[model samples]
Target: MTTTTSDGVATTRPAGQQPDPAHGPGTATRPRGRRAALRPGSHLFLVLTAAYFMLPVWWLVVAATKSNTALFDGAHGSMWFDDDVSFVDNLVQLSTRSDGIFWRWMGNSLFYAVTSGVGATVLAVLAGYGFAVYRFRGRNLAFSILLGAVMVPPTALVIPTFVMLANAGLTDTRWAVVLPSLLNPLGVYLMRVYIQDSIPPELLEAARVDGAGELRIFARVVLPLLRPAVVTVLLLTMVAAWNNYFLPLAMLNDPDLLPITVGLGQWQRLSSVGSGGEQVWNLVVTGALVSVVPLVVAFLCLQRYWRGGLTMGGVK
Candidate 1:
């Protein structure tokens, strides 16, 4: 078929066919123009953000390869490795120093992070599910209180937590750290929101119609659907427990019980004190590098779940 417009431009199409979408008015050209306008700025922003974050990690890597003298002496710049690289020497010193207490601190951090992460996730899942699924008297009030609790800073509660732990004879013990870490209000909030958004109530009602008990429905249906959110909450709580400093610092007095954060802080203080104090800045740098590896690996491994969860929640 052929047609002529008022401007006398001839157009042709196959018999009984529609106009080609690619040649449609403003369809391809408008999108291409918008993309062309946005791409440069977006690319620049992403590149700058990546450089900002990776710069510190790069410096840590370079510093870890240098010796104590090379670090302070300007033999090489802080951002580059020296010719006389002493990474092995630094690791050896790290292992031998203070009767290998660094390993103990690493182990303590792992324990606290894992224990608290799992504990907080379980509590959050149960609480969130209940909030999303069941309704009872004072439900709104209870949740309101929970939201208010979330607003209260964790640091502000540390003093009262310490007092209560001291009274319970748990201060300076691992429980003092792990117990306090398990109360993750943010995790609970996240789980509740995720549940409400992701899980359909009709699905649960269908499962109930099939004679599945509440526990069975949760285990068989809800959990499978909640995998992404669960992983997100787990990773968040784990990271929080891993990075927690003030709570452990106040609760623990024993060096043997200290996590990497406080242990490294002690070394930092010792290095800064006086001329007589030992300068283990190289060791400190190396330890910090080692401390970061687990978190990096964890993020790399779990990023798929994190991204999937966010995408799912956003879609819902």
Candidate 2:
């Protein structure tokens, strides 16, 4: 027997079979009862996982709202906001500290993340497309080298990178971080896989037959189709660049050139023995909170693109 759903998909079932206990009578409903039984357990697992990740963020939020005195006071609540709100005060303190150097670190982070993300995405697209479409000498060998690079840890390359940058007189500058960030081997691999799977050779052939040059064809035809992969690479590269610490720490000695990640670490260290030899936990918490807000906002705003990109890439 067959019946049409409200959405007009026809579903069929064998004769003499009763309706599923969880859903209606249809072939698709066979797993419904079992899935229903497992739903609560799955939901509980998801909730617990989410809470595990979010608990630290929640603690930071609550801590950001408390005064230094309240934070250290045994009588005050630890996980909740203290009696006197200190968020505004903390913000004021953080902004005025070190001649507003925290804002400079934020600007540096923005520059590095945005530029590196865009540059890396573009390079990945070009490299991925080349690897996927063109037959060349040592292509497999080159991609194998890329895969090997992916296996190697970034920390292992820091000393070597610093030496190279130092030799080129690029250390202690913005490019110290941005240049290294633009070389995302994983992004290239992802784009190669995505392009090979998602884009059909027939499309390229048709474009070629239509008298389009390789650059034109790629720019006009292929790029539109590769939006999902591009966005994914962009987000990944941006997040990595934004959160980068070690390279920046090793390469940049000037405080004026540090990214927010490194800058915040310095602040945390300074907080342990603040100016005039006093601990300044309020500034540290507030600065950390402020540093997080931009990245959080970026993720929230761009999440739709990120999600759609992943979904399309997966489906294709």
- Location of the lowest summed lDDT over 10 successive residues in candidate 1: 12-21
lDDT of each: 0.83, 0.80
TM-score of 1: 0.83
Off by over 4 Å in 2: 1-46, 273-277, 304-316
Highest lDDT: which candidate?
A: 1
Q: Which 10 consecutive positions of candidate 2 have the poorest summed lDDT?
A: 13-22
Error of 1 at 103 (Å): 1.4
Enumerate residue pairs that collide in model 2: none
- The all-Cα superposition gives candidate 1 an RMSD in Å to the true structure of 10.8
What lDDT tens digits, residue by residue, belong to model 2 across residues 1-316? 2457679985432211223333434445566576567578779999999999999898899888888878888245677778788899888888887898889889998899899999999999999999999999999999999988888998998999999999999999888888888888888887887777668899999999999999999999999888756877788788888898999999999998899889888767766743554567887888888889887987777765555344432232
Give the distance in Å from residue 118's predicted Cα in candidate 1 to where it truly belongs.
0.2
Q: Write the per-residue lDDT of candidate 1 for residues 158-219, one digit (tens) a residue.
A: 99999998999999999999998999876676677777766889999999999999999999
In candidate 1, how many Å is residue 143 off? 0.8
